[model samples]
Target: MKINYPDGRIFNSQPSKSSLHTTNAKKKLIFGDRGMTLEEEINESNKYYRAHDIAVIYKKPTPIQIVKVDYPKRSKAVIREAYFRQASTTDYNGVYNGYYVDFEAKETKNKNTFPLKNFHQHQIDHLKMCQKQGGICFVIIKYVELKRYFVMPADEIFIHWDAQFDGAKSIQLKDIEKGSIEIKADYNPTLPYINAVQQLIESGKEKK
Candidate 1:
């Protein structure tokens, strides 16, 4: 199978089983292959949101350039080599309550702080640009070790991001708690982040 990207790049969809095994092995060794990482949870939550007519958010697939392919049989083909063509804007984006919604989902094993290195300069700029265009932009951060999550506004994240040059490399857990909205994990939608988004929208109205 071949998948096409919006930029007109095409990639082979089939990956070798050996590659999958190796990737899963690495994940198991590092994160115990829990099969429920932050990305997966958010993806499931998006599916729920779409199903219930709540929102229409989706994870953006990374575009890749396929350089080499192997055809072992007449009916089978596999991708042998591939590389990223460029950096991605963010993890998720879509429409919610007539607002353009954009955000990135990130998780940290550190319990006390989230390292600023987890974010990229391009992502920060993208959020800033989106906010300027009247879009709701934020980041969903998960403290993996502590089993906690927060929906942090992009403005708050920018504050900490700018502080990096002043010798601040990470945001303290306490600061995150003070500046962000905590979200309770649930079974139905997994992360249920849309509720926090609703609160953010209402809070913005109150300020206005």
Candidate 2:
């Protein structure tokens, strides 16, 4: 299999396998290539949405300050020193169906829990602000080892986040299953998170 990037880069997908070279140890290892990372899948999904006029969402680019640069050649320049200007608010934000949408994408290898440390304080605060302003704020989390994905509302996430000070540093998988909507993976939009968003919207309306 081959994946072509927007920048015209082609990546060939190879079967990843490992073997133990011993007389007694003849175990065949199989590596699962779950296609793309959470970020890449979200980006591709956003692109598909934008192309189909469904929504306009994009990844927020982090601001960086380049202090030193060297012109290694006439055609190419090398960056020597650069620093982040500031922390970013969220991973993605835009408008969809006349409603503001804001979200962050995260992935964890742990199957039992999703750590609160994966998120920043400022990001949580930003999500809270967005929710207060009637924006649809949520988080897309992927459990790599389990091959599962979920879309959790920001308000629900805050409960577990605030509980961290009480010694709970992570949200248990069972808790996530109870609070979030599982997004089915696809090939066209990759993540198809909008389905989960629609479910969230309908649930909110029902609650009201």
Candidate 3:
């Protein structure tokens, strides 16, 4: 099974640092803004979907490899160092209306181009595998500096990735304009993504 890394990188499951809610809190304090991290926005949106029974999506837990352990107390063990193992799949996965949903959330500051380096080869492979299984796979990309968001389909990403070495490496904003679903900012869910997913499903149905 695919596992997530503590730093939001997905990897294989291995014993590692005991989860500290305090660490998550610290991360929030440092990164939190009206415009939170793209991951955080997706998380909150998932929570909203759960509460409303719209979909059952979640951010997968991270996998950690604990190297050193200290039994400082009878009740707790402290982990000192760890290295993450390789992940076998994507970051988020779940069922939405009987369809498999798998995707990643990312952010970029550039207004004209979305860099290909933001995505990893392993992640692209994972998404391709998921798509072959008739799953809906996409990325929720946030142009943070422009305050714009787009749900770019995995296939579109793959096309560029496949030709990246040939010099068509970057996903231009104009390209995104043609294929991606532009998401409007919302009050409660912040980055409303379910709407984008719904649009994707609808568009797929139209094609069929």
Best by the lDDT measure = 1
When sorted by TM-score, best at the front, the candidate numbers are: 3, 1, 2
Cα lDDT tens digits, model 1, 50-102, are 87899999877666799999999767899999986655587689999898899
| TM, every model | 0.80, 0.80, 0.81
> Which segments of model 2 are wrong by more than 4 Å?
1-33, 69-79
RMSD of each: 7.5, 7.5, 7.1
List model 3 lDDT by residue over 1-208, tens digit each.
2222135322222112333333454355244446356666676667667767888987776656779988885668878888676666667888888889999877888889898998898899999999899899998889998888899999888887887889876888988888799998765565677788888889989999
| Positional deviation of residue 64's Cα in model 2 after best superposition, in angstroms | 1.1
Residue 148 displacement in candidate 3 (angstroms):
0.3
* Candidate 3 residue runs with Cα over 4 Å from true position: 1-33
Tens digit per residue, CA lDDT, model 2, 19-124: 1122221111111125455765687688778878999998776567999999975568888999766565986899989889999988899989898999999899
Candidates sorted on lDDT, descending: 1, 2, 3
Residue 208, candidate 2: C-alpha displacement in angstroms: 3.0
Task: Evaluate residue 32 in candidate 3 and report its C-alpha lDDT on the 0 to 100 scale.
Answer: 40
By summed lDDT, which 10 consecutive residues of candidate 1 come out lowest? 3-12
